[model samples]
Target: MMGWDQLAAFVVVVAALIVVPGPSVLFVVSRGVALGRRAAVSTAVGNEAGMLVQVLLVAVGLGGIVERSALVFSVLKFAGALYLVHLGVHAWRHRKELAVTPEQERTTRSSAQILREGFIVGVSNPKGFLIFTAVLPQFVSPDSGSVPVQLLALGLICVIIALISDAAWGVLAGTVRGWLGHSPRRLSFIGGASGAVMVGLGVKLAFSSRP
Candidate 1:
């Protein structure tokens, strides 16, 4: 039941927010650089799907509960951090394999695993709850009849914007990766660098304090 004016404002705000690269963006781009555009897009979709879960919880009024519970937030954060670390370690160990033929890489790494990793990265990020709690309420009008509906609508918009924006990053990174893949030595270096980025992100997340 939000008016056009409100909807337009919300869109602008969310557009700005989505354009600011965050952890999700980093993960998607890294996957693109390491794997390819298809994997990157799949990861973006999975990440959005994971974010949808958070939106649902917020719509159902559980967002406050999550925000208030340090234990719950810590668990989610750690789960995401550990998953990223696992991915980094796996990538580092298989740098040589990464330099193999594209067909061989596809055979070794399944699409399902890539998507699952993206979903885990999405869902386990505790920061989503904070954003939902703080940002969604501002767009909800008292006369909107249903706050939950408004939250869902706004959350969907955020996710859609993010999907589009993050996909762009993926495509750009994938293109660079394609060029880099011309040489086996360069490909190996690319793999190692991507793994290091993931590990660094994981370590940063693990040590991050609650907001």
Candidate 2:
């Protein structure tokens, strides 16, 4: 039962944050460049699914514990970073696979596997969790029907905006992939470069201090 004014403001804030091409967007773009539009879209969907779960936890009050506990935060942060690094290394090792036609490259990894990876990344991302913990409560009011319901509604709005933005980025990257599909060398280079980006993001995340 958040007020229209609060909801609108929340939407604006979420939209601004989501459109900035953060780690989540980069991950989807990487999937698009390495895999294809379908994989990218699937990854976006999966990432949102994981985000939704985080929102649920936030609504249930567990999110505060995570926000307060440095140990838990570090554990989640490192887990996500390591997973991204693992994925980047795997992609770099298979960089030549991008040389295949889009149709064939799409088959390189199953949609389920891609989705699962995206989900893991989304759920384990300490940044995402912290954002929720910090932002979601601000717009909430005691007069609202239920704090949990308000949080869920706000989180859903955030997720929808993010999914649309991430999907657009994925499609754009996929178009670039299509353009370079004709050249094996360029496709290989794209793969390596995208993988390197992921690795860099992971390293940055690993070294980032608690806020």
Candidate 3:
């Protein structure tokens, strides 16, 4: 088992990592901002579950080669970027037609759908595997006793922080959306802006240098 001080330090580092605006965090926030807190949580949970698989694979060292392989990273990056672009384009196309009434938006999102969406967003991201493979091992010590346990602990910390942040975005978006229900045009613009941001991020990510 890891020492108390080590665990505490690990928690701090993991928490900071979670707070950073990475793909998972951004995906959850975007969902929350566009959907609702419940949907966000569903997405967060799914995303966490997706990440768990990556962490476990890394714990067993299955992902080490994948992480180091530029080809693998490039493939995943392009796929993820395309996914984001698709999502953005979809949002933009429908932005004008849908009325964002609370009742309507709330009714539209099933928990299952939210979870599935979150899972897809997290799984499709190539960066999470890289983080698990490259970044996670730096914190582990032979003295930690069980590397798997440590990895699990770190993954949980990340999930908790992501859930909190994403949930906040959902609540805020839902609230603002309700208040601004009268101006559908304004809401349409918001959707367009969000779509543009997603597309831009996708393009940037596709071209980003691997560490």
Q: Model 1 — TM-score against the truth?
A: 0.95
Using alpha carbons, what is the TM-score of model 2? 0.96
lDDT per residue, candidate 2, 1-211, as tens digits?
7667867888888788778876788999998987778888999998988888999999898999999999988999998899999989988999987787656755677889989999998888776787799988999888868888888888888888878998999998888888877888988888998889899889988999998
What are the per-residue Cα lDDT tens digits for candidate 3 across 1-211? 6678867887677666666777766666666555545666677888777776766676676677777788877887888788778877876787774465667776765788777767767776776776677667777777757887777677666556666765665667657655655787877776776677778768888888887
Query: Residue pairs in steric clash, candidate 2?
Result: none
What C-alpha lDDT do the candidate models reach, one value each?
0.85, 0.86, 0.70
Error of 2 at 164 (Å): 0.7
- Find the 10 residues in a row with the least total lDDT in model 3: 29-38
Over 60-119, each residue of candidate 1 has an lDDT whose tens digit, in order, gives 998878888888888888889998898888878887776777788789889898888888
Better of 2 and 3 by lDDT: 2
Q: Which ten residues in a row have the lowest lDDT in candidate 1?
A: 93-102
Off by over 4 Å in 2: none
Ranking by TM-score: 2, 1, 3
| Clash pairs for candidate 1 | none
TM-score of each: 0.95, 0.96, 0.86
Q: Global lDDT for candidate 2?
A: 0.86
